[model samples]
Target chain A: MNTNTQTTRLYHTALSPYCRKVRLVLAEKKIEVELVEERYWEGPPDLKRRNPAGKLPVLRFRGNLLAESQAIVEYLDEAVPAPSLMPQQPLERHEVRRLCAWFDDKFQAEVTRPILNERVWKKITRSGYPDSRIVKDGLRAIKEHMDYLAGLLETRRWLAGNTLSLADFTAAAHFSCLDYISDVDWDRSEALRDWYATIKSRPAFRSVLADQVPGIHPAAHYAELDFG
Target chain B: MNTNTQTTRLYHTALSPYCRKVRLVLAEKKIEVELVEERYWEGPPDLKRRNPAGKLPVLRFRGNLLAESQAIVEYLDEAVPAPSLMPQQPLERHEVRRLCAWFDDKFQAEVTRPILNERVWKKITRSGYPDSRIVKDGLRAIKEHMDYLAGLLETRRWLAGNTLSLADFTAAAHFSCLDYISDVDWDRSEALRDWYATIKSRPAFRSVLADQVPGIHPAAHYAELDFG
Candidate 1:
């Protein structure tokens, strides 16, 4: 437990999209957070103490331990209202939440988890070698998602609406993780790539850009400002 | 779509916790909602028309379609402020959202899905007979969750805080699905049972209690107002 209660701290793992979402939100809010990498799978004794949910991306802010990525982000947006990630209208806000769930639940289950489990987690956890079949399936599944996202981007500037809302950050979080492993085919959708590049260049995205997981290397164009 | 554009309609499935959570919130807010049972697994083309996410619990309110259960519930609470399911304070609201995620994500993964997939979905989807191994594992998992929830009940009057909030509805949604198959050993934790009983007796819980899935019989005490 970092006794520096004065400073906002985040207990997280780099690969987790949930954690990344919160981190992006915190950074976008301009809150300087002390990042503490937790090997949560090791079942650290203090994990349950910090969060009963026993999950990653637990935020210690203003003397309270907050869990659940969406919950924490929503709280942060409400607590510190600057450069608002959420829109004003209720309907727009609903779209933002829905897209957030799209990445976290649907996209994660279909594309991210299977691909990450086979390619990333297997290597890191020393579980086994990547399953080509699963990776192939995830890659195939991602095309449909890319197409759907491309359709959305054709009409709107961001994932959910016009302005860069939480939806954009939520999507960028997932894509960034998949990008870390070079799973994303930027050539599939130029619109999707453009949207991602726009969000990726933000000052708030700097910390995430610097993430370097041991053993795994970033893609050649990952940190580059203009890969095109 | 139901031609009664004036009335709020929810396209949902009976056993989906996500749907039930929305139903409970709408009922709590005393909003008259027309429930449309959607067999989303069948993949009707119009499903995407109603909800691009193509999931259950798509709410049609104020002539606009809403997807994502949590988002819908939050919007309902915001649109109808009289019976607010969310707390005023950001911290308390965070706790509510966190617990909602606990049941929707963790508990559903640990208990509801495995057991239901074995005992319920197998029958509904005509997949196969109940897999005792999965059923046993899910049942075993429920004990720990019951204990944890019981511990929470000991300290607070409600799941997230002192008042009945979205967390309780989110939890009860999963619990009701488990209870339908007589899976929950209500005797495991007296406090959990008591907590459930109190919530179950509410007017808002009526529609859910009356849920009768075809070919799958409800437990004898499921609909009883004062079942011990």
Candidate 2:
């Protein structure tokens, strides 16, 4: 477990879904980390050095630096092997990773990108030209994904499987960001809604929902949601 | 690990980086399974049923289905528990995952995407109008990523650290694809070139290099490179 290793340092943004996932894992593992808010949009020189890809959720451990959310999460899971975020079965683990990738890939591209465009990324990346069509598509995709989640939740208690895992945290991280803009339809699937409510109430999840980005505001319902 | 589960099947495509990562891990672990090639682009109904997200490298284990290369690899590492792909130390494990994520995320976005756009994705996805600018940018990015890899290799024998790990396999899978298009500048970094040759020479890696995608021809250099 490398008990000799000191508390890890994470460079992240308050509003990033990827960062939120890492934060949730850390909190679940009960590992204390020094959180450094990195202004990634500013293209800070130090942040760039921390992450060559110029992405957030970079971790500094024992004079070595690691980047990428998947890597960070897996590392955290392995580093602090308590309450086991990953399933022991190879196939079960695969399902968890697949869901994680799905959230990162399709969900991000179809849902998160659109909402972020309407909300945060539009002002951050400065690419400009936020088309309403994309937002409309994003809104639709969210409902579809939520339906899929509902179906999964129908059989299993959690997103990937029975026990709470990183898969739930990954999904919740994305949903939380969208919820900030009121983009997610909480009522779409009562099962997923209930699952989220349970997740949000977690002590680990509290910090995520409490997170605030400057000049932006979360929807009124965010504070009131109860997935449990 | 699961001799009785030898009926396990790996649903994969020959050209996919994610799929290839799983293959390398399986070979390294010396786990044998029936391989079923799924043409994700062709829209296989069975594949779709197996993975609602419709991705490749879905593992069928004892009537149980799993997905995601990262998840599959972790499962293999844990289930087998010999010649560990991940270090026991939490920080070291995180380092391995962080590098894997780097290749999968940043490298895939910057380097592999460009090559896929120019060489394969267009043919597979039938997406029209490829951007020349993006292809050029991808080629440029590969050189930088290679240089960064060389810096790491200069100090360590493998991509992540001293021992062979999944991190090397992830990098190699992407490089193999790029090598097929003759996109890599092999001579630019002698150290990386040598390290890759060593990995390529592994008995486990032979099948991956021998893979052919019907009409598309691989670079002549692909045949002559000796990992041994």
Task: List per-model TM-scores for chain B.
Answer: 0.97, 0.92
TM values, all candidates: 0.98, 0.91
lDDT (tens digit, per residue) of candidate 1 on A20-52: 999999999999999999988888899999998
Q: What is the per-residue lDDT of model 2 for residues A127-157, given as tens digits with 9 covering 90 to 100? A: 6766888888888888889989999999999
Among residues 3 or more apart in sequence or in different chains, the pairs in candidate 2 whose N, CA or C atoms overlap within 3 Å are A79-B90, A194-A227, A197-A227, A198-A227, A198-A228, B197-B227
lDDT of every predicted structure (CA atoms): 0.91, 0.81
TM-score of chain A of each: 0.98, 0.91
Q: What is the iRMS for every candidate structure? A: 0.7, 2.1
Output the lDDT of residue B216, model 2.
Answer: 74
- Name the weakest run of 10 consecutive residues (lDDT summed) in model 1 chain B: B1-10
